[model samples]
Target: MSKSDFGLFGLGVMGKSLSRNLAQKGFKISLFNRHVDEVEVDVAKNFKAEYQELKNALAFDNVEEFVASLASPRKIMLMVNAGKTIDIVIDNLLPYLSENDIIIDGGNSNYKKTKERFDYLQTKGIQFIGTGVSGGEEGALKGPSIMPSGTKEAYNNVSQFLETIAARDKNNLPCCTYIGPEGSGQFIKMVHNGIEYVEMQLLAEVATILKHKGKNPNEIAETLDSFKDDANSYLLEITADIFRKKEGDSWLVNLILDKAGNKGTGNWATITSAELGVPNTLIASALFSRYISFYKEHRVQFHKEYIKKSVSRLNLADDDLLKAYQFVRIINHYQGFKLIQEASEKFNWNLNLSEIARIWTNGCIIRSSLMEELVSIFKETNTILIHSKISKMIIDCKPSIKRVVSDCVLSDVTTPALSEALQFFNGITTQHSSANIIQAQRDYFGAHKYQRIDDASGKFYHTNWV
Candidate 1:
């Protein structure tokens, strides 16, 4: 038989779906999943048997056989757990692999670790591609936005298959690209999740405010569905579906717990932003919202103790809500891309913001009409705040957000992400900030120096205050 064109090392949900997608695209792929005795016996075998598209796939429980089945200059993708498991899989495959073979990491891994691996693989004469695959299980089976970073030569070797299996944009072009070198793909994906956190939180806040105004699940779903403009997105669509889901006449969304769970990407994004000295208050607020949700017992007790006699009604219109959502979303996207820009400069990645926005225009969870607009915006200017079109939109939408945020506050509604977004906007746009007082206070006690406003030479002055 002819050797397989590609090889995969994990048969989990994502791995299986990707393998099926590969096979469906006519790439003969060898599949392998480690045998875990009774727990995961015949994972690869069963996966191939279950998926008709993978009829000709080579399934192997033995690592050596799986490695040997692939053609020379092998391309193996690891879909295993991130962190230690990635290293473990690479170590196992190293003994069987030849020089110049490529290994792709397809999980949500930390970019720092990916860079380390990329460097380590180079010494062994093997190429490593750290790729970020977005869109959930469904997108994996159909198509997903793919961000791949490695040596240009290595990416060229794998571009045909990667592009073939990626989601297409409105232009019918694949939603995949060469992001940059040394883990920039993973870093971009991290920022994507950060923006995702704020987006989800914004939606939840809107739902809560609407529910407080006596809107039912179906009503809310319809209300959300009516946002046919820039607010339209994959996340918004899924959220509407979630609201409409019913379980024996009861809305499934209500029965579910108030707690939200995250798998570390949000935290990583927020941390990276702070490390890079970028202002990412919206994402931080969103991450904290999830943390706050985890303490259900404490929340309940605190709520009862702090309960007011009567809360005012949110008197904002659905139009107001839509305006607020769009305004906050633009800010969130700007913050996310700004973080990426800082990382690119610091790491010398030379990451292309326009390409990143373009790939995220489809298949990704955050894909939206806004992302479609951002593709050109980033091309014209890397900074969204300075872009004439976006700046004008922000200026026009400012009043609606103010009205919505003020109403939510008076009505005793918590809109952390929205409120933080407004604050971030205000802080960023201010010509003279309150930080001068902070600098003076710091100089008073800590001997810290302050820069003069009139100084064009970028000099600092230290003052002694009694």
Candidate 2:
């Protein structure tokens, strides 16, 4: 019996799958968990057989003992909970781990926290890697998009193993990459989850309306069926199946609560966006919606407050809803790009937006057929996407889309989730606004200075109107 090459420090759903994957991929696996019961001898036997003739591998009680069991210059992955638990494990494990022993934090960790941990580990002369693993429980078992960030040496240490186990893009490049020096990988994944929030909310709101309008779940499922033919993502494609299927007797989604639950990544995105002074109102609103859902009393109060005022009642035809749905989807896409732009500026990450869309085509939540087309739109056009082919689709559907928006306003049909996104998209793409000019005029008149856009120093321009 001897130490193994790869080790998983947590054996929750994700950790277990990753361990099995590494073992199946022919790596000797050293697995450990806080709970001894989670580590089974039968599973150990399965692993030994899966990768026949492997070196001796065993599970341990805690991080201290686990790190002690590993060979010199060790490689152990911590797939435990993201925030507080990560710190606890790293603190305990740091004492036993020597230099060049790469420790991979493969969880949905916040990028800010990732950066902080990187700096802390550096003080101890240890290599710390933070990777963003997407594709839920199943993906973790088979393969997942592994967005890793840390030092160059750290990436090289485990890149080959990561590439072998990671999910692939259309070009088949392992979904794993050295995103940037540190924190960039988690930051990008944060945006990915934010986009996911908006997408699901948009679909849920649409479902709410359709169900209320007396459309059977099957009929709605039938509508989703065509989405897979040309342009589709995993979420939409699978949602269609969920609606199309009949369990004991109800739509699976209907069985679940209308309220959504997020794992803090989306909230992290929204919070970071505000910190960067970036406008991510749509995603912010979607995140807010989840919080609002929790306040059952407030929702009841809101209904009573506006019940007499006639709020959020849509009497639109089916065509209008479809057009609005398509337009809102485009808006969400554009907003996602805008957030990426702001993030790039803030982090100096130099992210390729189109490549992001491509990678997301299958492995991530925002994957869609339309993303392939949008990728080309980004390649050809250097300006705002409002003038691109995606925007042109909006243009063709403008009449009905506008009718829907107008209906939302007049009838007080609160299209808050979708409308806010559309408006946010429109506000950014527009060139002139009398309101902006007036506000700037007032600022210059009162303060006698306006911030200069192209100045080497912190200079202000003074313009006096007679």
Candidate 3:
């Protein structure tokens, strides 16, 4: 074989699954792990096509040997941690890599870090790609979608193989594609995670409310399962099954900690959004949700002292609650999309927001059937939400949205992330001015620091009545 279309540099959960997946696709696969025996017996038993797959091309004790073993323009996908580990992997592999070799960082890497790595490697004619892969271990093992961004040359060398391995989106586009130049793939992935946070939080709030109102989680799941077409997302589809599960009086998710932990991608999303002057309150909300989750000890104190004020009657019937919950999730989705749309514009991402939806449709964590609608909208409009059919539908459904948001606020049912995110989205969309004036007043009187574009900087200015 030509020592092409086959190489991976990690044997962890994702790497192991992906390597086997590649072999399953009839690729001339060459597997490598730092640990020699890590993939030996496993591949022998599971990957039947690899009796000699690694015999001539097997594990390498070091990068020096692995690169020498491969043909020119070697393609190596790295499935490792970010930060220092990436540096270490790069340093070790650089000696063996010739010019034009491709190194992909497939972990949940910060786009800035990927950009830095890409820039550094490019000077040596080495190509570094920041590829975002989703579908988890199973996705990796069978066919996961891949978001790759780097030099077009690098993509040219790899597209055939990538297409062969990726899951297909609608219109038969490869689940894998070049997102954009430089860090866009990773940047997009970061935003994807951030949105995921909001969606999860909104769903969590619904589950909490359902349980509090004496409805079984299974019943909640059953109701969600009934939704079809664009209304159903992969997460909701899975959650439906989860809700139907019963262990005594609670679901398994109920037993899990409410606080979410992150490896800093969402943090990166929030930071980048700030730097680009893009508002990413949904992503920011996700990060805050994680922070709030960390207050386990503080929660105990709060439950004793603060929860007394969480009183309200939400005696809506299960059917009505289900209707409201689905509508809220739609609001949540649109709001997240609105944040994405606004951020892309403000950051000059010039990004195809609808195409972004298409990319995430099958491979990433946020993939859902609703993206089909979004993708169709993008095909017809240059302007993003203002004139899309979906936007029209959302307008028509504004009554439900308003009712749900108002009900949540009036009853104090504690949908802080979803409700506030919706309010933020709605305010921006309809040009809500009261809050902006209020904020200006607070800043003008309190810190006295925000700048007005129409006025000069450095010196402060304010008015009580003007």
Instruction: Give the candidate number with the greatest lDDT.
Output: 1
Across 264-366, the per-residue lDDT of candidate 1 in tens digits comes to 9999998998899998998899999999999999999998999755676677898888888989999999999999999999999998898899999998889
| Candidate 3 or 1, higher lDDT | 1
For model 3, which pairs clash?
218-244, 259-293
Query: Model 2: per-residue lDDT, tens digit, 28-61?
Result: 7677766446544344434434544333557666
| Candidate 3 weakest lDDT stretch, 10 residues | 44-53
Off by over 4 Å in 1: none
In model 1, what lDDT does residue 239 have? 94
Q: Candidates ranked by TM-score, best first?
A: 1, 2, 3
Score residue 240 of candidate 2 by CA lDDT: 71
- Cα lDDT tens digits, model 3, 1-466, are 3554567887778887777677667766566656446544444224334444333445554557667667678888888877789889998888778889899888888877888999999998899889888888877866787878887789888788777778778777878877777776777777777777776776677666666566677776765666544366767777777877767876676687666678887788778778766666667776787788899899889789866775465555555544544545555556556655665566465667666777777866677766666677666764445655556655655555455557766766666664665576566777546665765877767755454647665565555644
Per-model TM-score, in order, reads 0.98, 0.85, 0.84
**Judged by TM-score, which candidate is best?**
1
Query: RMSD (Cα, Å) of candidate 3?
Result: 4.3
